[model samples]
Target chain A: MKQLTIQSSSHAYDVIIGAGLRKKLSQKLGKSYKKILIVTDSKVSSLYLEDVKAGLPDHENLSHVIVPAGEASKSMEQYSRLLDKCIEEQLDRSSLIVGLGGGMVGDLAGFVASTYLRGVDFLQMPTTILAHDSSVGGKVAINHEQGKNLIGSFYSPVQVIYDTDTLRTLPDSEVRSGYGEVVKHALLSDMDWVKEVLSEDFSELSYSQLGDHLLAGIKVKASIVEEDEKEHGVRRHLNLGHTLAHALESDLGYGEITHGEAVAIGIFFAMKVSEKVLESTLPVDAYSAWLKTNEYPVEKLSNLNPERLVNRMKWDKKTIEDRIHFVLLKGVGSPAVVPIPEDDLVNHLKEFIEEVIQIDERD
Target chain B: MKQLTIQSSSHAYDVIIGAGLRKKLSQKLGKSYKKILIVTDSKVSSLYLEDVKAGLPDHENLSHVIVPAGEASKSMEQYSRLLDKCIEEQLDRSSLIVGLGGGMVGDLAGFVASTYLRGVDFLQMPTTILAHDSSVGGKVAINHEQGKNLIGSFYSPVQVIYDTDTLRTLPDSEVRSGYGEVVKHALLSDMDWVKEVLSEDFSELSYSQLGDHLLAGIKVKASIVEEDEKEHGVRRHLNLGHTLAHALESDLGYGEITHGEAVAIGIFFAMKVSEKVLESTLPVDAYSAWLKTNEYPVEKLSNLNPERLVNRMKWDKKTIEDRIHFVLLKGVGSPAVVPIPEDDLVNHLKEFIEEVIQIDERD
Candidate 1:
């Protein structure tokens, strides 16, 4: 088992990762909680709910809430329903909520735990590679109708237990989607790590190799989260490509594109933007080629309107006054938040969209 | 102005009390906020909204949302409507929310601020004396169908500015309601303070006298909240009369009885419970007489079912594993959490009910 502790002014918790580590939950929890509420999704529950329950300590009473599986589950309607279940089950401050699935379950469960009775103890049992990023930094949120992750808070978990056994059940597409965040983490952390991740064989990578990459991603997130728990400063670096990524997801309609896919496109655009604004040697075309090899939707920008996408970006939570800010990469491992003038941003986006469409035609 | 600082692990903020302090808000907050939302009830807005708006700095953009007055405004329906207004107003992380009314308004506004975009900077411009207690400790909540404050969290405000000028517009009933929380604070803080308050004339007390008492109440709350921010330990003492107070309000159907009136009855019963359980000298009858003089509903116990009330108390957020806990006074300024045997609680409550009914019959 690989274990690390994240310490902040508000809270401190351990992150444990290994194969079949979910079984150690009760032992790790020390049977301290009076009751445990296992929050999972339909798909995840059918696969591992009973096994997760059986792994819990006999001393602690357990209840389970199964939400719908997918991004759509992270809605206010679902959040309220989950809170209703929390009340129905009589879960109190002494109780524990175990998020027993991927990023959606983690975000939803963490948010519910944060607000229920003014917050309670929550444990994260991440079941996907994507959750390695979500589970670590304690950024739990439900999507607003107007924008993605527009309603959320910084609430740390009591512990995060990542079991590699759960990832084996994920489909190839889901795995690829998760890999996109891993790439973001790698690019933000170090150029060597980014190069290592790019060169790895996605389909045939060994379990240990995947675990190593996920751990590195978590470490990068943890360090940044530790420094700026509230996202007031250095933490914006983690947004590397999320500004346009959020716009893409909101404009195209959520669930039409996977978060990681949108992020992949955003990262490519950010690199191009970096080349224009910072004169950085990021090799945007080579990165696009790598994304294409991974079956990412790099060519989708051909059908999108630059103006519309820019308008959507204006409504992002990160916007300052009337100015829109983008977290662009100066180079691999070097990210900065720069306010692009509206006209400059539109022209650059139009040029970038045309270039992406030409690449699509050439392919 | 009398100012006291509430220091908690999560946050520390100032509680400022004075007449006409609301007008000083612009000077105090500076012009840093992107926008401000003034959340008040219709009754308060009709009387003070424009003046409150005039008090804001010209550089700071401000908006207002007036909710319905009275306890019904604390309902989940109103809470959702308030959230909708927050969304409509485009409140971002840089925004400020000024809760500009009584306890209901403070609770509702604080809750909305706590959750809106995962929390923003919120100030408490409490218009009622009742808010002397609610506005300080950051215990903001909306009511659930099952119970009061069932859906809530401990989110501290940036500052609490209690302008006694607004209290002049409140009716005698509102003043009495505000006084109950003041009494709770006195009972929890100092014995001499309690005796002094009990001997004071309710209707004849001057504005400055009320402000002095309110300041004392705020100090008591600040000290306790400072010691235990999250209510994990000594904070339960702050819930002194709240458990039964919640049950009384829930049983009597909310708007039919005010929060402080319910708390008044709860305090009287807790004293009786203390006399029975701890063999403490509390002079419950004298206190009951004082409550009666203040026009508090001391005789409402005549209509309530002890079994149902106990059942409701069982569902209180403070309960642990089916055990109902009550914060009972050992004497003035002394409180402790005690688990009453089910039969004993019901029997004592029945006895208490009989005594209250006899008093009602005599009247």
Candidate 2:
């Protein structure tokens, strides 16, 4: 077990990552919070809800709200229902609202905790590997009809407890989806970490090795978050692959492709753009080969219209004052936000899509 | 025009209070914000929307969203609709959400501003005198079916522009309702301000005098907010009359009674509780007489059941660990939060209601 204490402007909290950390929930909490509402999804409720409850401090009032599994659960309806549930449970300002699932449950519960009774004590218990990224940063939100995570806030939790034991239950697809972000974090750090993550066979990794990778990713994210909690500056680098990821999710009608899957594709596209636009010498071929070997749907770019994808990018929430900003890497580990002219971006995207298709044909 | 700069823990902003201050909106907005969405109410839209638009900077992206004018507008439905409206209008991160109207409008718009695009720039254009108190504190929220302000956050606005010229159109009842908070603010401050507000007739105060009173009220609230932005300790004192006020608002059903009127009654009851429970001589009779003269519906207490009001107080959002905390005064200015026994609270409430009814009868 290892603990990393993150210092955000609001407060400092510890992110404890290890196998079977759920049992240490009480000791980690440090203070007594009598009323606790555990928010989890349906799939995990039967698996880990009772275990989490049993791990709480004695005499604490506990209730569980099980939302349906998947991204669809992040909706306005669910947000309102959970808020009403908080009131029905009589959870007050001093109460605890624990998010006990993956990123979806964490986002919904964190947002509810931030708004309910003008915010209550919030704790994140991330079950899936995908949540290792979402739970660390305080960016919590529910999806809007027009866009994903259109409604939310930057509300940090008191403590994040990740019991890696739960990660075993995640499907192989979920594992692949989570690794996309891990790879991106590795690329964002340095060339050596990128090679380390690329060379390692994910399926062969022991729990300890997996914890090390998750910890590394979290450290990179936490450092950026600490410097720019509100995303007013360098924090924009965290969204290195997100501009295209959000556009892909919106264009493909979310749920067709997993978030991290889209992020993998986005990271590939951003790297290509970096090499082309910034004249950076990033190893695009090696990154592309790693993505394809890892089963990322890089060939999806060939099937979709580059124009439509570009249009979707224009509509991304990160667009500032009608100017579409893209976070591009000058090289491995050197990311910067750059605004590309629409015409140049469209032409570059068309050529990039053709090159990807030709590479797939050769394979 | 009086400009008072308030420094909360989050940021510093100016409260510009004067007749026709809206005319100086462009000048006061230190920077250029291209996208401005004015979220007002049906009543305020017709009264000052165009004038506000004319006062804005040239060639800026502008839109307006108007909800029905009343407490009912502060609902999840309205909140959801306005969020959708923001999306429909293509409001970006750099946009400004200007809330124009009374407390209801301010609460709804401020909340939407704080959450839209994970919060945007928010400005308060308080049109009603009742708004002078609500606009300053950054206590923005929407109502829940179970309670008032059951969902909200402590998100501050960039600037608060109060044009006292709008005060002239308020009905006599509205004037009385707004005065309840003015009176409460005076009570929270020194005894001299209390005498100044109490001694004057509500009907005859010129806009300049009204602005002075409003500025004083704002100063009291701003100082409290600066000390405790999230209502941790000293901030609870600002809720001196709010314990009964919220219970009254909930029990009586919102919109049935103006918030300030309930606050007026709550203030009177709190003063009596202070004298009886703490053995403080606060001159409760004089305060009761002042309420009567100001046309505050204090007599409604006699018609209601004290037991029910006491029960509702226990369910207040401010209730910590099921303990109802009431803000009490030792004298005129000094205030503290005290948790009273339920049975004692009921007995005192019953006696106080009877005492108020007798005073009305003798008059």
Best by TM-score: 2
Candidate with the greatest lDDT versus the true structure: 2
Every candidate's fraction of true contacts kept comes to 0.55, 0.80
Interface RMSD of 1: 1.8
User: Worst ten-residue run, lDDT, model 2 chain B?
Assistant: B316-325
Please list the residue runs of candidate 1 whose C-alpha ends up more than 4 Å from where it truly belongs after superposition.
Answer: A57-60, A283-286, B283-286, B359-363
lDDT (Cα, tens digit) per residue for candidate 2, span B1-363: 898998866789999988887776888896787688999999989989988998887645888889999999999999999999989888888788899899999999999988887889899999888898999978899998778899998888999999999889998778888888998889988888888877877767777788899999999988888888888889888788888888888887877789888888889889989988788878676777778787787667767887898888877744554457789999888898887888888888889889888988887
Error of 1 at B181 (Å): 1.3
Q: Which of the numbered candidates is closest to the native, going by highest DockQ? A: 2
